[model samples]
Target: MYYIENVDRKLFIYTIKDVYRLEASMQEIEKMTADTDLVRISRTCIINTDHLKEIKQVKNSRLEAVLDNGEMLIVSRKYLQDIKKVFRRDLS
Candidate 1:
């Protein structure tokens, strides 16, 4: 899976060429994929770190996660440290 997102209380799984609806909540998916490369970037989105390309700083102290597919996702301040820790771990 590339990324899983919760929109309007529904989960959507996005892949390279398709998107699928999942009968699950973000919390449930997180627990199930805790051991995987997936990391939550926002309240409604969890992305596969393996597919993450680069992180860039944006206006207003916010950050943006650029994916390999060229899609960008905003990284909220609340989860900034968590995402940083994940990348730090990956590098080491």
Candidate 2:
């Protein structure tokens, strides 16, 4: 599962089959899910690294994470280092 904050500022829990509303902030979810597969990829998105399918360089030094479910999410340059660390840890 993954957690994302929509444009309406509402949190949603995304699963492979469904999306349910979550009544929690992204920060709270991030902390609680820390040490797990969840990794913050941007200000509004926290993805399950286990679900990551591909990381592609999109231009301007930004990246795009394609999830197993075929969802593509942006990885802003600000969070690039952190995402790289996740990949390194996984690879190691």
Candidate 3:
């Protein structure tokens, strides 16, 4: 499972089959899942690396993470270095 913050700043829990609002701040959720597969890819998104399908370079030198469910999430440059470390590959 993973969590994403919507435009309204409400947290939502995402599963392979469903997504439901989870009343928690991103910071709180991050802390709760710190030791798990979840990683912060962007200010609005936290994903389970275990569910990652691929990582690709996109325009503006940003990276895109493709999840197993076919959802593509942007990985901001701010977190690019961290992602490279996790994947053990050079993203540049």
Using TM-score as the measure, the top candidate is: 1
lDDT of 1: 0.86
Q: Candidate 1 deviates by what RMSD?
A: 1.6
Clashing pairs in 1: none
Per-residue CA lDDT of model 2 for 1-92, tens digit only, reads 74465547898878867888988888898889766667888889888888889888876566888988788998877877777777777777
User: Which of the two candidates, 1 or 2, achieves a greater TM-score against the reference?
Assistant: 1
Q: Any residue pairs clashing in model 3, and if so which?
A: none
The sequence of per-residue lDDT tens digits that candidate 1 reaches over residues 33-87 is 7756788889999998888898889865778889999999887778777677777
By TM-score rank, best first, the candidates go 1, 2, 3
The whole-model lDDT of each prediction reads: 0.86, 0.80, 0.76
Clashing residue pairs in all predictions, respectively, total 0, 0, 0
lDDT of 1 at 59: 63
Off by over 4 Å in 3: 84-92
| Alpha carbon deviation, residue 67, candidate 3 (Å) | 0.7
Badly placed stretches (over 4 Å) of model 1 are 88-92
Task: Give the Å shift of residue 3 in candidate 1.
Answer: 0.9
Least accurate 10 contiguous residues by lDDT in model 2: 1-10
